[model samples]
Target: MIFLAIATCSGSAFAYRPFDGTDAAVAEPGELEVELQPAGVQQEQGTRTLIAPWTVLNFGLSEEWEAVFEGRGETPLVPSGPTELMMGGAFLKHVVVPGSLQGKDGPSVATEFGVLLPDSTGDSGVGASWAGIVSQRWDWGTIHFNAETALTRDHHADVFVGTIIEGPSKWKVRPVAEFFYEKEFGLEETVSGLVGLIWQVSDKLSFDVAFRHALTNRHPVNEVRAGLTFAVPLRFEGAHNR
Candidate 1:
């Protein structure tokens, strides 16, 4: 069997568990949310890539702003190669037109921008990216749309568009699906789909599992992912006085 440790891996800064797209929402001020994947597997062309314990940290900067950090550790299952740290980045997300996602009326809107860091191997270079998100919730379900562009590690321009659909929010356990198309200018194009389930255990915690299949330039890639997300509140005693 093949093993991998990559979490919600994507070309941009905002892809979260079970989905390659993110909602138009930000954490509440002084709150922290952690997204973790203990193990994930991806297989392509008779080779397997294993990344263990992918992680993303989100910290609330204000009512409408958040700070994000993402990274991962990749290792060969047989130790054929040295372990490396990859997919590192720092980002900022802002809620622009808060509506349904923020408990208001219409669709919520947000944007994220960041710099992508190089991995330990240095085969990739530093790059930049930005994404826009829109989300709407109905009595039956919720939908999120995302559009993003990035200057890749190889210095190529990459563009991605994705959509996510989730079952009724009232359900403790809900079915989720994501579909996306991405293109790396002068390179390959990818079409991908994912199906998954999310269990909302409590107000502050959730778990998810998903399976994804993608066709890149007619080559197939398959992946399995499982992870959890939890929130914590941060307190600053004298913050109001500042």
Candidate 2:
């Protein structure tokens, strides 16, 4: 069995960008970023850990139009239960207002709508999820704020708000904080925060390190996460840019 700690973090290409609420629904044009986070802990019964990997790819349809595809998988290595795996559901994000941000040079308000495909474990059945994200840039840093909810056949819904604080540094390090509320899954709720450092090694390669801690004990897990992020430019020719 595998014992893994639970950690929550945002999956956006611009790690330095702050929470603007509208940015979560919009996809950047002609951008592809990959993020991988792995964490685990030892349990008294035995040992259990969680392995989660996710990737996001965005394509520019026009100057203001962009298409996005994202996929994520979670595998829990537990001693007694079956190996749980969840997969599928590709969503599309559209930028409602283009060139509304000062620093990121992207849309300020974006809308994201997608469907979650069923998985082998049956933990989350097939359903549709939708959310709105707003992103804005500040003199000190960039901010991204997002609210997401799930509309499924199983009558499940959740709301989440997060902020990313970008520091004044060459590597573009940012600290993140988030609060989550869920009506489904036995009225589970949590508040978590993470401190992360991002280094743009090159135009296409970057590394990220983060420590995550949960503020509420409502959930039976707490964890720290460390991972690397790589961005690959597609159909664009130039020096590696963030």
Candidate 3:
């Protein structure tokens, strides 16, 4: 059980649970979504695993704006023992361009800005994080680009750039893939790739499974993960009695 209490994912991915990525949209006002992913990996010499659950809470601040809240708990299997980490944050998202079901030409554009709070050591981990997210969506697929820079208590800095991609979504099952790269201020670079699928059971429930392989020999090893995502819309009861 290994966990990385990294970014607080925005509320837009259900078919993209395997990759640590987000979409360019936010939940409707008063809508809540939760995702649980339990995945691991196998390598030449050892294995790595993680069980983490994150919740996305969104409230429509306006017609085109949403306030987002995300929180997650992770328990990772490490060489010493199982370590627990908690991460959460609040974010704001604006849908600059909206995509429609029939619209296939233009891309939906959105931006997210947030701060990350993590419970970990200052030496190898982050004390705080400042992140900016940009996403684009077309008829064929979607792309999420992330740039994150963290502040460490010990005067160290780390930065990450992640690119997340998913294929066409007009089917019961859709293909999802990702390529992620990270570089610490003074450390070597690490790169990873993943391929997976998103199974849509219905509009409200879905499942995702993915396998990650290391492009660089230094980090990530190999991993297999699966998760479920569901959304529940908040509604007010109406009086039906005559």
Candidate 4:
């Protein structure tokens, strides 16, 4: 009876993947990044699909800082149910060190803080979350790790630990994989893993599709997700600014 309650997207054109865990970098000052998921599915006793669409909008405010907005509208695959908007989130991310996008460098680090806003003021609820990230560029590919904690409106706390290893980018399509574990206070723990691909269509556009399966019985059997991400330059401090 576990659910794929939360999902995320991040910068890969600038140095991360859409479906992978977040990287230790933020959008450059004056840059804009958007991710759109056209289709996503989760299966438990039966198939539960998300058709209302999911989106993430990121705006660069400074060289090492970015403002983010994420929202997902849910329409469970029932023929007669109306779509109910889920909680939306707003976050601020700061990069402590700008890591190399490519190379065998040490790593980049960042921190993020955010709040979840309920779709309505009808006492639905809210949540707060924070995360720390570490990422490194390797000869073979890139690696990223995230440690996150959240306090939902119900006052329950949850923790997530995730990591991603993306394949080399010499080709138009790159393979990526990740493993994640989550622990919910007063609830059963769950472990899951993902395998996906990043299709770099251009400097500003990328597409991704991924399959996630639960490693523990506390979650849905599997999930299928496909999305597209695009980066638009608002303004740049310099030529090297992405």
- Candidate 3: where is the Cα deviation over 4 Å? 1-16, 38-47, 54-63, 76-80, 100-105, 120-139, 149-156, 215-217, 239-242
Stretches > 4 Å off in candidate 4: 1-20, 78-80, 102-104, 119-123, 215-219, 235-242
Best by TM-score: 1
Clash count list over all predictions? 5, 34, 10, 2
Model 1: per-residue Cα lDDT over 66-173, one tens digit each: 998776676665435676776667889999999997889999999999988776676888888999999999989999999999998789999999999999998999
Of 2 and 3, the candidate ahead on lDDT is 3
TM-score of each: 0.91, 0.69, 0.72, 0.83
Q: Give one digit per residue, the lDDT tens place, for model 4 in 115-189.
A: 766653246477788888888876678788888888754557878888988987666898988887777688557
Who wins the lDDT comparison?
1
Flag regions of model 2 displaced more than 4 Å.
Answer: 1-31, 38-47, 78-83, 99-107, 169-186, 215-217, 236-242
Pairs in clash, predicted candidate 4: 11-16, 12-16
Local error of candidate 4 at residue 9 (angstroms): 10
Per-residue lDDT of model 2, residues 1-242, tens digit only: 11111111222212221121235433345665444444323232334555454434455555555554444344446654554444445566766665436245654876677666655455656666676667666555555666667655354564555555555334444444443333434455656565656666665565666555554434444444455655655555554552
> Rank order by lDDT, top first?
1, 4, 3, 2
